[model samples]
Target: MSPLNSTFFINDDIVHPDFFFISGLAGIPHTNYYYIFLGFVYAVTVLGNTFVMFMIYSDHCLHSPKYIVVFNLALSDLCGSTAVIPQVIDTFLFKSHLISFEACLTNMYFVLGFLTMQSFTLTLLSYDRCVAICFPLRYNDLVTHKSILLIIAILWMIAGMAILIAVMFISTLSFCKSTVVNSYFCDHGPIYLMACNDNTPSAVIRWTHPVLILWLPVPFITGTYICIARALLKIAASERLKAMKTCTSHLILVSVFYFPLCFTFALASIIHRNARIINLSLSTVMPPMLNPIIYSLKTEEFTESIKKLYRRTMIHITVRKK
Candidate 1:
């Protein structure tokens, strides 16, 4: 029987529900406050990512290869937040916990896809820093805005396809046992756990998602930083400090984005399911809201760019007042 099409697996006893019940943060106390907080987070995430994208577009100085990755990261952050937060608010905060099967799958696509893209985008930034620091002489030739854009386009496809495949496999699972998805949203793990039929492929894909999204990128980024460290040794002390300082934001971003997620995944077996859900939700919402803030505050170019944009806006407003 084909796993992509569950028709062959179907029997009179097999059952599929039109909708799934999202048991949001069950057994967690005072969850409404948390959702309210997430609403605030959503607002910040939207504003921050939008501002970063606008600055990257308006400032010619930010039109470089590195900011291309920044732009992509902001874009992913925006979309990823939109994918996960609003539905979470609606589902749990407002008590709209019933999600149609199709909507559930759609949620899986975006929540997971943008997540995949977000991770890959960070790795892309590491590459940018890697090339710039380790291959200083050929940095211009090695990395360009055009090449970065192309890679981003390709990555979007890869992340999308990877998640799409997983969602497809999920669609084929017969939810004969239970339709209660114990998550804030349509989590791949929880959803597949509800399946009654052969979930071997689903199980493999479950691991595959983290492997591609987290495990692989972590090591690759580590290696790049190692190379960066080695290269730093040969440079003048003054230049070395400046180069290392430039990497601060990326390092901070990687730590914030990856560490909590890695921790949550690592302790999934030991922690309460509700705790895991909260951690995953926080890991999702926090990074997007923080990414633009970190980049603007940490990176010198972005700080100047924001000041320039602010000055221009104020000048434009003052001129209109006349």
Candidate 2:
């Protein structure tokens, strides 16, 4: 049987129930290697994102609105990684592929919610950079801490509501078809596809949701950066360099986070479903792991703060030993 069509059968006489089986990285050979590798990735993702949050919280110099936004992104990454990876580890390593109906829907809600929040957060970061670079004098006046917090509150509220609506729609569907999910995690597409009832709602959500969450912010972010680039041309060469430096880390993050998603969506029709699912899983885990590394390496401010934190930690450790 094809991997995509693979299903678990307890016995010919037994009936399948409501629980779904997550077929993680199907058709991949040497799954033990993948299990070990994914465990390492999850560990790094947790440690990296936690370190970013710690550095931002402990250091006052990194308390600017820009870094505050980064802190939020790190938190989202940490949450997203936590929500998806452990269950995936259980599914793949422990062979606990079966997940209850309610648990699957709950996982889908949080994973999708965090994914949407990350996209919106990136857009906010882009806007923040645009304001800092384009309207240097007005940045402090325009994007104050209060305003940023308000925006963040609104973003979270919107994300939560949107995902909740999607989940409610999914809950209404009767999943009478096979409960085998052709993915490593509980994603909307695979889960909804398994429903035997009319999939019009899922199809509608699949089509329209991306427009609102993904395409909408993309053009805005692109236009904002274009404006930033134009503004850079009008400034002094030194000022231009500094402005670009401020944006470099965010630019890298945007590329890393969005490119895979775009590629996955674009090539979804051509690629095998198993491959697509694997790609989606990698995209989900990779950004969380890479975000902190990009920020630590590219942003001089964060790098310096991290170095100071390291030295202080080492000193404390030595003092304790003595």
Candidate 3:
């Protein structure tokens, strides 16, 4: 057996057959610590994203197009975290590393799909902000509620179609050899690399899709922000502060979303495999938990709404008790 091929024995008869085995954070000491930490991270991710979505849904003041985009981003975060973290916890804490072929593919689909959705949503949000700041007089005509909804719908459609194409190509491949994935989750690279058949199409899709998703939007968003900054330069100090405040949270989110991803890919060549896996896993969890917190802290409306909701809940509780 090659050094790369790690064998997992099942009973006496089955010896490292073609079964999916997740290799999570190998060579890490004190895995229980990782378990507890990741459990907390997952819990926070779920609760934070859920609360953000609820805030967007319940608060009438937050019915604008920007907040609607935020709500959808929260929804995507919720879904991506739910799809990944539980399986990670199971694999790490419960020693349940074996995943079925069908389940792995399904997980892969949602993970990639939600990630694409988030990228597209962020791009749309940047464009929305650009229009609002650069052409305030025409922003209303350019980005109405109906138009935002249409853009969001198109975003979902495009993301779904991309993933569906990749999934269809993946489905046609054969996994007759080693099915052990050297990562915590069923990532496209790791899983597709395990295929024994021709993976040229899968490789092309996997490589090109991420480039298209990440590279295409990044320059546009950066340029939009640059324009926003230039536009702010001409305004009064107070107005400039207010406009920049509106963008700060989103800029933070973009950093949080992209920085780790970029770093992970850049360091993959030099970092230890175990460290890379650990970094990748944490990257998946950290942004979802942090996004809502950034929004709540930076956005005055979200904070006020949260306070109002708290007050109303307290008053209702007191009345019920009395």
- How far does residue 187 in candidate 2 sit from its true spot (Å)? 1.4
Candidate 2 Cα misplacement greater than 4 A, ranges: 1-17, 314-322
List RMSD in Å for every model shown: 4.1, 4.2, 4.2
lDDT per model, in order?
0.90, 0.84, 0.83
lDDT of 1 at 159: 94
* Per-residue C-alpha lDDT of model 2 across residues 82-118, encoded as one tens digit per residue: 8988888888788787787679889999998999888
Best prediction by lDDT: 1
Error of 3 at 232 (Å): 0.9
Top candidate (TM-score): 1
Q: Between candidates 1 and 2, which one is better according to lDDT?
A: 1
What does candidate 3 score on TM? 0.91
Q: Supply the TM-score for candidate 2.
A: 0.91
Off by over 4 Å in 1: 1-14
lDDT of 3 at 178: 74
Give stretches of model 3 more than 4 Å off.
Answer: 1-18, 318-322
- Model 3 lDDT tens row, 20-86: 7877664578878988887898888888989999998999999988899999989988898888888
